[model samples]
Target: MDTEALRWFQLVCDGMTVTEVAHVHQVSQPAVSRSLARLEAEVGTPLLQKAGRLLRPTYAGAVFKRHVDALIHRLDDGLAALTELTDPRTGTVAVAFQLSLGTFLVPGMIESFREEYPRVRFRLEQSHDALGSSMVAGGRIDLEFTSRRPRNPAVRWERLFAQPLFLAVPRRHRLARRREVSLADAAEEDFVMLRPSWELRTLSEQLCADAGFEPRVAFEVDDLPVVHGFVAAGLGVAIVPATEGEPQPVGAAAALVRLTDAGAFRDIGVAWSRERRLLPSAELFRRHVLALKGGRMPTATA
Candidate 1:
């Protein structure tokens, strides 16, 4: 069961004399012999035998060596991988981001990071949780590029920037020609919205309230693009983000108008679990992402 015994048995089987193996290991020949004896005893077979003058493995030892070789090889590889994971420039980082940011913001940041740390590998994850991403708190991810700042104390958030929210309406709509409009101006219009669980939906509702009118809900969808599509189809109007970091593309059927109201922009940032220590690679990548902000403070309408 001792690894040293198995190793000695393997070496002896590989044609090394007990004396030679002991000399190489700086032990007595009897020590090597004892190790071989214990190994054969444990395996319940004579693994090594004297063939004329050279020491060699028996058929059973030859068969067992293959399994031992594989085990040792895997163990060594695992140790190396663990060591590599701590190397800042050559380690792996696991990153998670909201689905909306995947189009531009998150990917652009990752691409820029890889340019500097080409040797570093990344594991990417995407989440659509509308109530604020919880992957960090659960330690499922090292960092998350998200729009809503997490409310969990276990998760730390950094304000990167704000994505300005825009009102998208059909090109033929009365307010479509306007470059900018008040949320109150469209209060009576039927609204195309993401599900109520979505953060943007919550924001739209609050902004509508501040504007002194509740948006009449009409169509509900799961994704921003779909919400935009509904607006373009004249199903209803929807609030969307634009002219900012990786804003979703608006189709020609829909026109985006800037909103003139308090808190019209959503804060986009990164979240990480404070309870877990990030590997050197991930920590460095986090720094790289933060630096991308270029000292820009988040803007809020309210």
Candidate 2:
């Protein structure tokens, strides 16, 4: 296979016009055209067809693109691993985490990590707590910080912290007068809740069910920031993990109250696949996580 030609073809598949790809690579249009012809000849099929002045990939090209994308991703991962192995301090670490980790855990640890390894680069992704476990399990990310622990046999976890759930409400709401609220009390009110798929939402629902009432959901959203906004706007109250205790919503009024009968709390942790060997950068992250004041490593699962 002509790796260079295939790479150029991949770029064209990614919405780059022939002239654009040529310009980026500092090659003439004729050179790019020749390379594409050579690639199509080698593959024994046309990869793209002209649609007016623009080129679009054929059905076969679409299939090839999926395979090529996976190949390119694996190659990139390999390069990243090689860079780490050659110079661990100068390589990049790709981490994915839920918002709470981004808001609370990463800021402090990233500062300390960068001070010790000044050359290390980090690529961070903030995802919902619901998807964090699956992202780690599928190898889409090196390390994941999530509130929900994976039940998958292929994944391993380390408990980082436990945060108590608190009722956040607009200050003018009737319930805002209370210092603390019971789960039963919360169930009676219209709630602005996390989407049902989220771990926090599942926990809230379970708690409400235990209280013998379904929560009256007035609004539903995925982000805590948005949830705070809705609650602050006097839409309804919600239960959120009290990681930093009380958080004041900007441009909105809200207060946090402890939930009495919501006996359970959410556990935030780092999860990674047990089947895959940890990359050097990922191992460094594992060390940093363990070093957190309340973090504890779990026993390796069989």
Best prediction by TM-score: 1
Candidate 1 to truth, TM: 0.84
Task: For each candidate in turn, give its C-alpha RMSD to the true structure in angstroms.
Answer: 4.4, 12.9
What does candidate 2's lDDT look like per residue over 1-302, in tens digits?
Answer: 77667788898888889999889989899999999998888888899998876678999988888888888788889988787754768767778877755655666666777777888877888777763345777776778778777888898888877778888888888788898788777667889987877878888888888878998999999788888889888888888876552334456577888888746578877788889877776678678777874843222222
Name the regions of candidate 2 deviating beyond 4 angstroms: 1-81, 84-86, 131-133, 245-249, 262-264, 293-302
The runs of at least 3 residues in candidate 1 whose Cα sits more than 4 Å from the true structure, single-residue gaps closed, are 1-8, 16-46, 245-247, 250-252, 294-302
Q: Write the per-residue lDDT of candidate 1 for residues 1-302, one digit (tens) a residue.
A: 88777777767767788888889989998988888888889889887777887778778988999888787778779989988998888898888877767777776777777878999998899776488547878876898888877788888989887778889999999999998999988988999988989888899999999999888999889988788788878898988877454444555488889998979998888889888999999999889888867453322221
- TM-scores of all models? 0.84, 0.66
- At residue 204, what lDDT does model 2 achieve? 85
- Judged by whole-model lDDT over C-alpha atoms, candidate 1 comes out at 0.82
Report residue 202 deviation for candidate 1 (angstroms). Answer: 1.3
lDDT of each: 0.82, 0.77
